[model samples]
Target: MRHILHNVYSYLTRCVFIFIGDITLNENRMLIGYARVSTDEQTLDVQLDYLLKAGCSLVFREKVSGAERDRPELNKLLKKVRRGDVVIVHRLDRLARSTKHLLEITEYLQHKKAGFRSLSEPWADTTSPAGRMILTVFAGIAEFERAQIRERTAAGREHARARGVHMGRPAKLMPSEAVLACRMVTDDGMPVAEVAARFGIHKATLYRILTRRQAMKSTDKSLNKIEKISQTYKCQLYE
Candidate 1:
């Protein structure tokens, strides 16, 4: 009985001195840090130092590109973080490639009831309400920027249309080249492929040009036949 009582007393005594609200030193939950770099030439020392000074007891480090999706250390850190524990990084860019990725990581941590913090971006601390609010502000700014970009792009396109500016890739052949290609195909009896090569145009474009010339010739012949019939009727009426 006395041994059990001594153990209880010692546990309570230590509890009284413990900072219950501080998970970084709570002895159960902890603050974990992650550091990364793109290439072997880059060093993790700077990020590691920041995380250590910020109260992280354990840190995971790796050398990998931000564009790379398979970061073993990062995956392990994400899996290892428990509820009430914090994941600290030197900066947001140190952890994620873009804002979308940053939000994804934070949302995952939030769902797990874990916290995230950036030593460089104090506003990115998810352990408190202020930091979360700051995150909201960032999201709003990103939305506003996208809206502005869309609006400006639409306006610019309208302005370009008003000025009669052509959009998309410019025509491969100019008017003179088109006329020459048609003459080569129709008059000179050159093969469409040979004309296309000589004019630096695609065979498909040459086919279109050839089709247009045939349509124009058919229309011209129809008009001439109509004119000849009208003249013959006038001569019979005079007789």
Candidate 2:
């Protein structure tokens, strides 16, 4: 019921725009075209011919899949668009990989005060107020879904942490193995490289583990000496 209300509101808003005559469809606006093919085996002749006949002043062409995010020609056309310019494509699929992607592109064009149009899918055209209203509602819904996903992911991570689950990669060496490696290097006076190779670990890693163990031992000894001094001072005070 709420979805129906949103659609009705969007339709009403589009009507208001049309009634106000705030946006004109074909008044000194440049039509920029973009043509794309998934592979070299697929010829772009049909798309190019259609774009040229659509009165596009300039057309950017490339042979790249819509799924690929780094399309050079599409990037160029997007950068070329200015305020009041309409970007024309041979088909909807030629412009974006999915509905989310289409909404994102149209949102960007709208931000630039430009417009988007599809030769095959007339309803997808953003040059008209109705098309803009429809796409805006879709973009809003997509954003809401994405926010829900992010919230769920963060809650899941927090739950895992509360249950004492490790989040990242497991440690390479066990506690006993690390203790033995450090002893071999320090007590037995063995070469660090030889000890590391025998344990099938990197020399640098072995050094880090040994250094940490040594620092821990040093701290323990210091704490023991401090306790002894405190005990002796108490004896003197009691005497």
Q: Could you give candidate 1's per-residue lDDT for residues 1-239 as a string of tens digits?
A: 35434544553443223212233424576889999888955577878788889889999997887767667787678657776888999988888877845754665565456678888888898776678666655544544444455467668889999999776732566433454455445434556665564344556666666566556776654234323333443333323
TM-score of 2: 0.58
Positional deviation of residue 53's Cα in model 1 after best superposition, in angstroms:
1.6
Best by TM-score: 2
Q: Please give the CA lDDT of all the candidate structures.
A: 0.63, 0.65
Each prediction's number of clashing residue pairs? 0, 0
lDDT, residue 97, model 2 = 77
Residue pairs with colliding backbones in model 1 are: none
